[model samples]
Target: MIKNGYRNDCFVASVLLTLYANFGELGGVEKLFRRIGDKDITAWNSMILAGARPGHGSSHSMQLLQELCQTTLLQIESATWVAVLKSCENESDLVAAFVDIEWKDDSSWSSIIGTYKQNDMELEALGLCNCKEMLNEGVNFTSYSLPLCFSACSQLSAICEGKQLHVLAIKSGYNRDVYVGSSIIDMYAKCGNIEESENVFSEQLEPNEVIFNAMICGYAHHGKAQQAIEVFSKLEKNCVAPNHVTFLALMSACSHAGYVEETLHLFTLMLDKYKIKPKSEYYSSLVDAYGRAGRLEEAYQIVQKDGSESAWRTLLGACRNHNNTEIGEKSAMKMIEMNPSDHAPYVLLSNIYNAEGKWEEAIKCREKMAKIHVKKDPGNSWLV
Candidate 1:
């Protein structure tokens, strides 16, 4: 195609770039991407995604995005901002990219705020919404941006901020929006106000799947298994189809309430009836349910079948609680094999040993952690 003078064709080059990225051919992707004469947003997005891949160095992707930003003729779409955000390694990088945009659109604000929330920087995410510069720039909150701000408030348990954002949503006429409503429910529930969450949920006359999932998740977090189940019944009565999040929340609720049988049944329903394939979280939840019911062997068996690091860690945690040194050691070993740098398995294994009065083994576990330089992260309080 290149020999036939199709090299500079935007569509063809963009397709080639995506193919190279998928194949992990970063060198060829870069070479061919630079050769495209009339580079469109598609080409830029392709290069950005390619460069952001695991080993390709997000710095290169950020550089490419910066170059694209400098090209005044090309319009940077939300997709481009999303691609660049994926390349941002830290909060500073995200803020820098956010502030660099000359013309901030609703999508741009949503993208950066959502990224901050995803990175667990909820305070920073909320800061963007209340930032003096953004306020001075006359940035208005739309449905898209409002949902993310609500989610940030949820993460931080910032009830005051959440209520203010709720008012903003209502004032902007986005209170009726399904996504925004869901976020509001989630925010209220997470801030220890399930009653308000229920109120918000009840007000949504035409509750969709997302809204129902949020309500169910609220119940799950509050250990209201019966309430979650009742909501699920209503969801079915209303003929609203439930998705993975719905079942995950149900499983979590059942697990927390020690309703092991209910949790198992929901797992089967999700798999056989809903045909939803279980991911690591699903498996971890199942292991947690079984472990909480004092079914350590069953939990271990589930972990063996899944063989994911998360499942193993869950099982290890269960073993620690049950004081099952044997299975705890196995789970810890499996987790270590999967991710040697993780200090969680080491810490859990040591706890398991100490719980069983095996002080020597616990000491050995700590020594191994030190030898490997696997430093455990210090705990911090979100309230502060």
Candidate 2:
């Protein structure tokens, strides 16, 4: 097309740029972008999207947006801002782009808040959602934003903030939304108020699979294995099909309560009855259940069959508690081979040796960590 003198056409050039970006042809995109003499907003946005394309570093996208802001007279709209925001790889870059947006629309607000949630900046996400300035600017919280806000509250265990958001949901008539209801349940349960979670769940007029799953997970987290099982039975009676999450939560509940046989039964039911393939997390949960029962050999056998690094780590931690140096050594060795840079396996190994009264072996584990410069991560307390 360029050879046919279509290079000067902004629309044609923009389409070509998107095609190249989608194909991961960054070099072709760069050359073609430079050759476009008259660039419109469409052309500029295409270039930005190209830079923001997955696997291509977002740095170039951010740089192009910066350059476009300083050089181009073309009006940067919400779409342009959203495109660049998608490329922000870190919190600082995202905040900078957000500040640069001339008009903060719902899309922009949702993008920033969602990014904050994804980056584990739950506090920041919640703060922005409830920011007085944001509300005064007439940025109404939509159903999409409400769920995200509730999730942030759940992560922080901010029951006070969560209740405030819950009231907002009710006022906005979004409390009936299945997603919002589910989030409310999760927030309440995670904040150590399972009764409130139950209230939220029971108040739903027509709960779906997601709502049931949320309630079950809440019960599981609180070690209410019987309640979780009853919920599962109710789900079956209601003809609501259970997903993988349902089984996962049930297995977790059994594991927490040291119900190894029930956990095993659930795993079998997931595979044979539900025909849902078990994930690595399922295997890890299974190992955890057996380990909690002090059945290290059974856990080891399960690990050998289809264990991931996480499952091996679970077994190693179990071995530490059981003071079984033989399995602990093997589990640690397997985990280290899977991720040599990880400090968790080494730390668990040291703990196991210490538990067994092998000070020299524990010292050796520490020395090895020092030699590899694999520093242990310091723990932090969760702020209430």
Candidate 3:
């Protein structure tokens, strides 16, 4: 009693399966598949896409696909196979195995290349890039695939390859695309070409918030705190209201410069002026700023205000720096109470006792740690 008078029942079943899959009702889709008796190629594709979509599915979606490929001996469409391969890139062994599998078309090759890039398998990604040239099959690289390859070049710090990709992006008319533009900026930043990053940012036809955030982070990460702050000022003047990420970049800059007053001012602005509630990361940065400046009391006060374990740990670290046994003991107790398995506070407390010449107390602390199997992290000096 189907109303549409659709002659092909399999087509109707496939449409319903796709609907269920898209809505994440996989069990319902499976039930429909079972009722349909003989599932067609479209039905199988619908099921495959269901598992490949971002959330509410297993990472083993690709394995399921491989199983399907073997059982049916069916020629999987390029789009379906590409989705499965993209999922496998996260597994290095799988990527290596699948590289030998026959692809449907050039798009499939681009997909595999992009997958390798996304997974940080730069060598594999580069190999695919070289393979495309060797074949000389006139493969048309899509906008989606080019950014990913550019990302791999960025990670490898291959300035030459990155520049070539930028030129390709311009030629493909994707230079103004937000995703492509962001990748270009990130590549320049990673290659230590801040001027190039800035130039790209300036030429962006419609720079999105992500592009601005990347620029800000690049300056902050390279110790150009002043430049980071200047970017924020420009963002404000341009009337692009700052988001959470914008504040994070600003806070990072403040933290690196040890500008306590400015840090406090920005922190307040985030909460009051901007009306953005401070996230745990924001609080942690504030604690780090106060701690590094040897303002243990200020660090302690921030933790007291926001009762987060991460904030407490930051305060405890500051206590260790100042060797404030009293505050250290309190912070350690609080941290342990928050999460007993945390080893940091115990080690910090023991160090505090050792600094105060309380060897017996330190030894007792060590023994307690031994009973709980807590181990201290190896100490390494940070130059900056």
Total clashing pairs in model 3: 0
Runs in model 3 lying further than 4 Å from the true structure = 1-42, 45-114, 117-123, 129-135, 377-384
lDDT of 2 at 222: 94
Question: Over the stretch 97-136, how does candidate 3's per-residue lDDT look in tens digits?
Answer: 4554543345656656766665567877865675346246
lDDT tens string, model 2, 223-286? Answer: 9999999999989999898999999999999998999999999999889988999899999999
Instruction: Give one digit per residue, the lDDT tens place, for model 1 in 1-384.
Output: 999999889999999999998998999999998899888889888889888787555678767866776774676666776677677676677677667667776556776776666667789989888844555887778777788888888878899989988877777788899999999999999999999999999989799999999999999989899999999999999998889999989998988889899999999998998899999898888999999989999888888888888889889988889999899989898889999999999999999888889999999999999999999999998895
Better of 2 and 3 by lDDT: 2
Query: Candidate 2: which stretches are off by over 4 Å?
Result: 2-12, 15-44, 47-79, 82-109, 119-121, 131-140, 363-384
Error of 3 at 260 (Å): 1.3
Q: Of models 1 and 2, which has the larger lDDT?
A: 2
How close to the true structure is residue 118 of candidate 3, measured as C-alpha lDDT?
A: 57
Give the clash total for candidate 2: 0
Question: By the TM-score metric, which is better: model 1 or model 2?
Answer: 2
**Which candidate leads in TM-score?**
2
Question: All models: lDDT?
Answer: 0.86, 0.87, 0.75
TM-score of each: 0.69, 0.75, 0.73
Which ten residues in a row are the worst by lDDT in model 2?
Answer: 99-108
